[model samples]
Target: MSSDDPPYLMALPDPVGAGKQKFQLCMSELLQLVRVHLPGRMAGAGPSEREQRIALRKALGYLDSDYLIDLPEPFFGALLRAAVYDPDPSFNRQFVEPLRVAFGARRTQEALLEVLRTGTNQERAGAARAWYWATLEMVEDIQVRWDQAALREFVVNEDIDVRRCLLPQLPLHPSHYPGELHPLVAEAVHIGRTHPDEYLRHRVELQVRTGI
Candidate 1:
């Protein structure tokens, strides 16, 4: 199988480790634990975006200090993997936002780019999932680099999950891609047209229609 093939397609053994298992469990219990440990930090009805961001930070501090202090790598990866793989986009910010804040946006973006370029299929998908939150207010140049990398991955990666995670974030319009890279955008459109996943087709159609 090619490098872009996902583990399942290659019949590879499960890559998840003890730390990841524990992190998944922690995520399952996250809301309840946050309520217990950081009561009233969560906003009430109709809270502003800033209020919600503050609440998320407070809860993350509690988790880092208490729950995840002992979590190891091969899963935690200093919370980068955990943050990206988080099933909930909104809750994923619990990890992504803190990394950007603590490490600086440029550094965080570089780390994510590394994951996208060389990590496992799951990691690549997670990086895509976490990309938006990490790039908030980032410079256009950095954003373009990420866009190019993601577009390349999307064209070559046959993993449905990875493609699904990447579709919404990819720049579908041809204008967004440079001259040499325009073919990648075409390949992505072709994949979207041919891929079996309904979500992928729908996202691609929507993006193409909107020219975004």
Candidate 2:
């Protein structure tokens, strides 16, 4: 927010934790911060590492005195979703570790869909993209034991958004899904032509033409 932004934007009523005097923040505020700064702030980070630390400290001080947030399940879920996608690229294995900390940890499909349906637009998009990348990781781990159909059945989720996301990705490693290959390509073509998203349409069109 700008310097003139309202106080209520980061206001809080309750505090949490002992002796530490942590302040609580609304979930909406957290999402707002993520939406506001995020990687966008990385563009012009600082003049020096020390300057960056001071800037971060100043920003942190602006947080509500109730700095200890107790997130509801859905917000926690959103946090987990964000953690997986926004972290260091080398920590792909560590990314999945969020699943263990989430309430819907064991129910992968439900958890995935829940995040998609309820999280912020950017967040849902991230989780949807993460699913495709995560599926690729699983394929690498189990391709020797799992067949094409079995893998597809388990990985290709019920959500159209997710299915469409994964379809174009499949052909990238085409030698694996020998049996179900053609139909998926056809589906991708149909989606490209029919789906509302122009980007997905263009992507599918490219994949079909290039046979990727």
User: Per-residue CA lDDT of candidate 1, range 89-119, in tens?
Assistant: 5667778765666556787788888889998
Candidate 2: pairs in clash: 23-65, 23-66, 23-67, 23-68, 24-66
- Tens-place lDDT digits, model 2, residues 1-212: 34454322211111111111110122233344533544332232254534533343233222332321322345344444443344222222233333333223344434544555555433343444445434432434333322333234324444444444344444533454555575653554565567775555556556545566
- Positional deviation of residue 3's Cα in model 2 after best superposition, in angstroms: 52
Q: Model 1 residue 97 lDDT? A: 66
| Collision count for each candidate, in order | 0, 5
TM-score of 1: 0.68
Q: What is the C-alpha lDDT of each candidate?
A: 0.67, 0.39
Model 2, runs deviating above 4 Å: 1-79, 84-125, 131-139, 142-168, 172-181
Candidate 1 residue-wise lDDT at 30: 42
lDDT at residue 54 of model 2 (Cα atoms):
38
